[model samples]
Target chain A: MKILFPIILYLVVSLLLLAPCALCQDEVSGCVNCHSELDDGDIEAPTELFKNDIHNQAALGCVGCHGGDPTSDDEDLAMSEATGFIGVPDPTDIPKICSKCHSDPVFMKSFDPGLAIDQYAKYMTSIHGIRNSAGDTKVAQCASCHRAHDIRKANDPKSSTYAFNLPGTCAACHANNVYMAGYDIATDQHTDYERSVHGIALLEKRDIGAPACNDCHGNHGAVPPEVGSIDKVCGLCHANNMTNFDQSTHNEYFDALEMPACETCHSNHYVDSPSTDILDGETSVCAQCHNSDESPEGLEAADGMRKSIDSLNTSLTVVKEKLDESDRKGLFVTNALFTWQEARQKEFAAKTAVHTFDLGKVTGVTAEGLELASQADVAADDLLAGYVFRRAGLAVSVFFLGLLALLLWLKARQIDARQQSL
Target chain B: MIDRRSFLDWLLGGTVFAGLAAILYPAARYLEPQEIPEAAISSLKVGTIEDFPLDSGTIFKFGRKPGLLIHDADGKFRAFHATCTHLSCVVQYRKDMGAIYCACHNGRFDINGKNISGPPPRPLEEFDVHLKGNEVYVSLRG
Candidate 1:
């Protein structure tokens, strides 16, 4: 009874677990499943290959496509010689398998169909598809980046080909320098990208738009660009700026000197906020190229502007100290009222120093120094008023105490006089 | 008759007394050690127990601070300040190693808020938690 009972339980569990997939496998059970019995057809395209495919893992079986009595285990009943069981799909019909979901507008809407269109069209043009069309079957397909069963949103950090992870995905193939070297391909793109501004910004700041290797090179049908066409790639966004840069004397000078082009100032990867000081005088980026002695005027202007800024900063420190002192002495109301006035003056002074070369702005700048002095006078007046209020309270309290003491002394004298009279 | 001289003396004495009182009041305030106010505690909600998974550390946001909610394998739930006391970077839960790690300076904290490694001078701040029905509550004071 124990042995029989164990066998009965095992059968019940197995039947329950396998029921769903077993039902699915009855119909459209492909040629590969029955291939051993059949005398017709090549055997190389193994059913084992489809085990890793998305449909198989999802438990959708061969009956979904080939169509027949999936319930019937008998070969003759399941495989009708005429109309029952169909064979494997042709290479041409591979698109139909993909299009089942891809062609459905509603199903593909969540993924943004425009992206799929571009991806599919680009893939067809890619070397993989071209070779596959010519009957070379080992190239990558749609399921490569978007995994078979584990497909997910691009924004998900865990997604295999997410923006942050794309480099690592491409590096799987491209970073193998030796393997790719045979194909005349260099994998140094990853190393160079890591050092570029785009790479640093993407890694450090997590900027999504910062271009990686796939942004510049095609993910599927990538090719190297001509040396003359380098500027065109850069000119996509920096067209007007590059045009002016091309006309500038620096471009030709760099060409002659064998120095770096516009990228020397702007940088190629991970470009940052440009320093305004760079434009103010020849001391910044220009100094990198031109000798400091050659441009005396530019160098002098930069130094003068710096000194003015420093002087204004020093003045601001003095004004802040006095205001703070006033607040500490219970002159809060007065300081609060006009302190911003003095503070604004200091701010304007700083602005003037920063833009000293602009004479028109500096003329209006002296008003801040005068305004600061006037506001300090107002705060001093407010402090004097508070002192008077404090003094008044003290005077009244002291007067009352003194008057009471004098009254007590007089009453004591009266008492002594009365006692003497008695 | 109250003479001008006497009146002036009285006024001067009153001013001195008032000035002294004004100075002393603020001085007393400065001398007193600030007691943590009860009003500050009332506003803090460490979050309910259901919000935290019993087997993992869930991050809870309280005011400007982040708190960690950890559920042990034995089904016990605990919450600690996510801030590293050393430099204030948010500490992360390392599920595999069963420890909390600070990325900025590598400060490490054990499950009980004890500073286990790196330069942290103190343990993480722990809040008292209670479960009522399905909801969990955290208090500012343990």
Candidate 2:
């Protein structure tokens, strides 16, 4: 009887504590509950699936959008009673749902009035949206990338779209062997990307210039780009290189002879490790297009760039050796070359620069190679000065001390002789 | 007659004065009165708190610097600098993506001013914000 009283008292206190929350519960249901089941075909609905979302936890509820009786417990009445009950929306209807909040200039202006309101229109024009509109249900929808619930900030590491985590998210579909096998799509893109230069740059060196999945693929309306479009996209950042490549003998030859341009030498997609070694200058990319019996122009153009790259590499080697010797001799050296220790740094810049045919930048950077050589020479001069002055000082001091010792011994002998004579 | 001790003192004093003049000449050139005004420390009224929609961001220009005022879905107000940490590019808020994105280098920042992606070296700095009556006051230091 005594224990029963305490249990009843505990229940009463708990209920009293829960009363405010229960009263406020009506303002906390999902927008889907009321708006998702209407007969309106145009209304794209996400359903009450977002009830467990963080938005709901913040007291955002169903009546906030799809007006309904929140207090009603009856399922049939809850479905029938809501004012703006829209039917279950298809993938094509996602844009309408997204645009409801996004398109309202007044609503968005409160947050970012200047925010772009054209995402829905842009998506419609995108390849992914077009394919999805045609009823390719397997295509990624808004919820696929953005997530239906648990939607956090994109900057959140836990968010699906964060750079480091995006590869894994993309792999969700791309790595699915069964899904890929149907379309003959190789599942090795994620693996291959992990090993590519961009992959190594991003994953190992944390270079942001290294392209991620979306760098090549569109963020919202992703699709496979045409082979011809790759250079134009890649050229956005590599302007100098792209310009040189277009003007190079290869591009000229291709334009005149009606052959493929730079991609002929640099294959698309599966780019291999580009080596700048003089002895190993001959590349398979050049050999494929040039060495063939039909086109001698490809062979000649490849040889010219190959020679320039070789000379640059040789100059760098000489500079590096001399710089190392200077460092060993205890001279401090500072320059762009000394700062960029990895050979790949200059090689990447030089190789791309050569393709652009910007002889000025090519010459300027290549001149830095000669300048590094001069820095080595200056370091050597300083070393010689140190050695000469230090040795001369030591020799003079030793000679003077020897002469003084001889003079002192002679005086002592003279004093002894004088004493004997007396 | 002038004593040797007095003559030595005069010599030492002359040397010291010369040394002080030499050092101060270059330092005086380097030192200049600051011309730029310090950022306002007191909170300035932005707008009514009710004007900020839930789970949205509003960009406002305070002085010469651009700032983003974000009202989270929970009705909590936050302010972040619009400048990028990497290259000082202006960042825009993508509400659907829920990130402050820099288009220059694809830099991304969370609503809480954390660097999520791209080449930014540090998180975006946040401005202090408070609500008084119906208006929102943002601190320059914040």
Candidate 3:
């Protein structure tokens, strides 16, 4: 009786240890099977679309969100409200539903510990959240951007919030005049953004590092930048340019005049690449604020900055052309090419330095660039001269060798004649 | 006074020798082992535990790049790569904010090296911090 009791106790302990392993295995939900069999498109569609959801991939069942008796095979009993089943949750309740699992550190740690938990808190401050809470059904909710049954990780290429796809996802409602008719904002943002430098880089070049719709406009707490905050928003990427702009004389004037710093010159969505041409003439960005009669000093500074950039740009172009010419001749202009690259960086620095609005600061960088360009120009010239010298030396060697060959031929003929005579 | 046969033979021998030397010299160098610098140090003794006061941060050179070693207010030693994820600009620990801050763009990273705010798309890479007695050592995390 004692031996039997010990064996029974051992078996019971072993069963307790193995129980978690059995339950931890991928669970097959009976609800999906029953829903899949249903003739109703609304019922069957979730089961089909859920196959691709991030939750489904993580082995979470339909009961994870829409709770029901996942254990039962009977259709009516399985979906009973007694088990806390809630189907087709309202838009307002979706955030709460998502945050229940997402915001739990202990629960989320098993999946992704690095994922931020404050998305719901941030969303509450957004315009969409405020409008949605006010009983407006038209505004976006958690399910609006991230589809209910087919939500994916933001990094997934197929995700609605992926860097390349995000602009288009936002444009679905934003670009439609009918949908956005109630809003006071212009609907041309998506169109303008599509043609912008950032858009071209992200969508065409597939550069994920480039800013998307969410980079400037917050992903959850999205709002338009006010007049005072425009420079701060633009400064995130162009840190040096922002630093210079902050110290510029125009900063206080722009603040007093209520002009947006970077956007005033570089336009917000449709920022085109700037050139020296923008510094002067009828199309000058400065002309919008400064006139020739009233602010002649402003015009003078702008003109000087333009000439400084042009001078350095012209020198870089000429040096680059020389390097290309030398390279084509197969003169091995590696040094000259490297010098030109350094000069190119200096030119870029000078361009960014123009935000200081000081002629001296801009010229300081440009002067260093001009020196590098001059060095490259000299190196290319040396290579060309060396090529010419090598060509002349080759001609000299060929003439003497030809003369030697002729003499050898004559001497061989003379030896043949003497042998024949002997 | 030299005959054509003898002169041609001499020239042929010199040309073949020159060609052989040119080919064999480069081949020998290619096969030979180059004296490269020693392998990168896997673990570095940053300093003694006493060198780092509570909540104080210090920067040290790790190989060619910079590394940030912080003695947090929690009394744990942690280290991270000092470069910002947004740009390649070097980052500094902002004691005031109690976070790794990049002044270049105001990018902020939490103690766990997770990017909290600003333009950083990715997190700063973290290194393993080991304490052997009073000596603190930082090493690459496996």
Candidate 4:
């Protein structure tokens, strides 16, 4: 009784201790074990790659996405339709699958409390989402931008949705003309975006703050901005210019004409650095809509604003030239540099103020700028004049000192002669 | 006493002093820090309560930048940085709109300085409005 009772007690205690661990074993799934032993690369790749997946790290297994029996060792049982095994879900069903867990605040919060749960809700509003709902299989889904098995956090550099990689990820579907054949939209957006000011800043300069494909056109709720809201989209970063434009006379006129406020002047997707030539030169954007015959007032305003900007620019150039000259000559021009910086700031304000379309308002800012530039020019002039004065004084001192030395030399010669006679 | 040697020594000494002064005078001026103005505007007495009527807002200069002060419909005073978060344009209070408006992008902020609409990515920076004997003063928030 003693030997049998001790053995039974030992077995019962061992089972009691290890039963919870067995029940709680998330990694005990049959899917990966069998999938890893597959002869086919296509069937086996996911098992190997998913070992390092973010979902795996979070303790989610194939059953979480594919939905099958995880504990069963029989291949037929694990892959059986009766167990709800859905192998290779359709693209249209991808959002539903992802949002099942992602859309639930309580479920998402358990993993990441701060993670946004609105993506699925916002995705429904997007063109892609609307198309996907209509049974269009080619449109982007959750797995398109974020890969199926190798998903990582958006902030991860290796993530497909990382700011730097997002462009290429979007381009994968968007850049293919054949893939986008039925759509009315152009496929040139990706290539055009690559050469744009925003793209250069983000792609080449690696400035994450620079807007990517998702900034203007939202990521989940992507849409082309309306004509009226184009300025608002651009103004998200170009706040000062938007401020001037929103209050300008052209705001109502453009709204009535259905002309995009910013895209009319700054081309969408391929915006280049705006030069003053766009205002007064042969390639004037204002001249496109305005003429000396019909829209005389607009052309006049453009001319006046252009001339005001030009005047300040010319004065600034002159002042800068003078400052540079002083610096080159090794003159102390700190005060002048400070004055130049203030003047340059005013010039920038004036340029932004041009959106006001008020000639007087632009000239008012430019007038202040011109005055500051004149002051800087005067300072630079003084620096140059002081240099000249110092040089002249030096010449005069050298001449006088040379004359004194000659006199001293002659006196010494006379003294030597007198000493020899003695 | 009036020898050439002494005269030469005096000349050399004057030349050396002039050279040293030329070098050291500018250096001293360069090294000497400019007297700093109030390093930052932590606090300012913007105006009296009477200056801003009920349900009124105004932009007041706070040092180099501008600040917006509002007297809400509830008769409470609120102050915030007037600059728009998107493009740094000075925001204005539209009486008809009853919200702080950035004319640049139609960005709107509530009386509480929260960004409500348009393109601004951040809310307006709020300040503490202190009332002392009918005088309204704006101070940086703790």
On a 0 to 1 TM-score scale, where does candidate 1 land against the true structure? Answer: 0.37
* Number of the top TM-score candidate: 3
For candidate 3, the chain B TM-score comes to: 0.72
Question: lDDT (CA) for every model shown?
Answer: 0.58, 0.62, 0.81, 0.82
lDDT ranking, best first: 4, 3, 2, 1
Q: Is candidate 3 or candidate 4 better by TM-score?
A: 3
Off by over 4 Å in 3: A1-28, A328-330, A407-422, B1-142
RMSD of 2: 15.9
Evaluated at residue A99, the lDDT of candidate 1 is 60
Model 4 residue pairs with clashes = A239-B87, A242-B104, A243-B104
> Each candidate: how many clashes?
13, 12, 0, 3
lDDT of 1 by residue, A1-422 (tens): 98899999999999999986676554325444665345543443335455554456555665545545555667676756454465554444444455666667786675465545345455567765675567644345555565543455566687666778877666666777665665555677667677666677566667654556555556655433333443445544334344544665545666676655545555543355433455445546546654567766545554554455444445555555655665566454333334444344444444423323343343345446546655655565566665676677557656655655565565567678869999
Clashing pairs in 3: none
Query: Can you tell me which runs of candidate 2 are displaced by over 4 Å?
Result: A1-26, A29-92, A252-274, A277-282, A292-297, A321-349, A356-368, A375-422, B1-142
Tens-digit per-residue lDDT, A101-153, candidate 3: 88888999999899998888888788887887787777778888988899999
Ten contiguous residues minimizing lDDT sum, candidate 3 chain B: B33-42
